[model samples]
Target: MISACGRDNVGSKNTAQASHSSADAATRTIQTVKGKVQIPAHPKRILTDYYAGELLSVGGHVIGAAPLEFTNPFLKDKLKGAVDVGDPINVEKALALKPDLIVTDSDKNYDQLCKIAPTLYIPYGTAHNIDETVHLFSRIVGQTKPGERLLAEYREKAAAGRKALKGVVAPGATAGLYEITDKGDLWVFGPNWGRGGQAIYNALKFKLPPKLAASNKQYLQLSLEALPQYAADYMFLTSYDPEHKGTALKNLRQSPVWKDLPAVKEHRVFYNDFNTFYPYDPISITKQIDLFVDMLKQNAKENKPGQGQGR
Candidate 1:
């Protein structure tokens, strides 16, 4: 009886070891900002601190994400099953979800996150632009083929929009983006900043006027009076209204300085809602291309006679 019992115990131990080995084999290694991490090759649940839209675009299954990420219009429907883990991620909830892979923009709580699962840390701005952002996420999810398809589609849309915008954004006809804060401060944006820059500078390929082009800043602080100094022929404006009613935007419209600008005088100024172009994702950027093209087409110099005839 003792010999029979010993044989059964050994068989059970061998089966457990085989199962553990199989589980280990199912995982694959990938390099992140924190170095190499072995993650499930087909992760069943993915949790991201930010860029949920970027992940979803590559067809990755997201289970937990940042609260604001849930609000992205471009990713709204696709994130139906995702959990909003609050402003700072709710680590307890993340663990409860049993996410096989965790991805975050910052290294904050990385040790904690890793305790829950294999965490992939990606520092913000790791990808210089939206296309690279898409490709990077695709590689992270092991969906490179789908990522290539999505990128090609984006390029096709961008190409079509850029072709249509060629005549509108003629030589010397520049586009500059600016924002008015609830505190009544005025700010200007460069080609790489999040505010419609992807569409204006990247997609439409507008001619940046001399004054606005020479400044080396991505975005800058300037007084309301200095608006014209940095203003382009086509002005794109947005208002920052986090804690107040939209009185600053109203006041800017009422101000003589705003009304006196050439872009305003010629009806070349376009006001964008803060949420529309604020998301710096490929999906949101693609939507922005259409929005920008429509605005330019409706107000294109040639479309309106005597508007820019002399220029």
Candidate 2:
């Protein structure tokens, strides 16, 4: 009968090296939403439940993240080896990656995640805006310098965009962002939420309807029949099945209430996929500014005043 081999001689060098690496690995302590915790000085494999895009912009080595981060086209190329661990995050899948650090926006399974690696808890709406979020993530990854550079670049682009779009788009033009879920739920995004709201309202300086702006809320749920009550100059309707002939879109169109809106009547509405501009991360925001400028410019050129999408 064979006996189990011991660690006396088999791959001794590798074992020694691994022990040395563990013992010599540098660490740093920082205050997190869950209190202070020490982590690797430079994390190599990070799995996050949300805001994965913020870390990616600062040259983070993300190994796994949630499904939303993987779906954004702007971030897809940067996430080469990353997989979606799950929205709430599957601890088993997270452990399989052997992540050096884990960041999550929820407290569910916090203890379980800590067993796999040094975990940092960051709740949703922790930062007031995307710029603050970039600063937050950069500090978390010890990438503050690069984060500063990215913010400067984003601001510079917005400045140039503001000048280029001068007198092109209608002044005081309000753009309303809406979403139709697979379940036919209608949502209006506030300034802080993603789905291109930050790009359109903050970076581009567009206005929301007076009522939506006054409410100061994250999202406003509205029935299809109530849509006409808060119409704007332009509308961006993001849906789960943007390209396909989805039931939500069909149902919305069938309602005479939708057809009577001024923005709809003038064809100043765009139907976009949910993932198209879902990520409001700094990197995505930078790219989105360029897309918004072009889209608004094209809308102005294509439609005559009070004719097509936007006057």
RMSD after CA superposition, every candidate: 9.8, 9.1
Question: Which candidate leads in lDDT?
Answer: 2
Q: Give the true-structure RMSD of model 1.
A: 9.8
Local lDDT at 153 for model 1: 77
The CA lDDT at 10 in model 2 is 34
Tens-place lDDT per residue, model 2, 1-311, is 01111112232121001111243457655465455556667888889987688888876788898887877888888887788899788989997999888878888988788888877777667776768777677766766677888888889988888877898877788989888887899988877788888788888888998778888887899988777766688898888664465888789867888888877787788776577677778888888888888877887778786566532
* Overall lDDT per candidate, in order of appearance: 0.73, 0.76
Across 143-228, the per-residue lDDT of candidate 1 in tens digits comes to: 67767777787788789997887756775568888899999899888766678787778777786656767876778888888877
For candidate 2, report its TM-score.
0.86
lDDT of 1 at 58: 80
- Summed over model 2, clashes come to 1
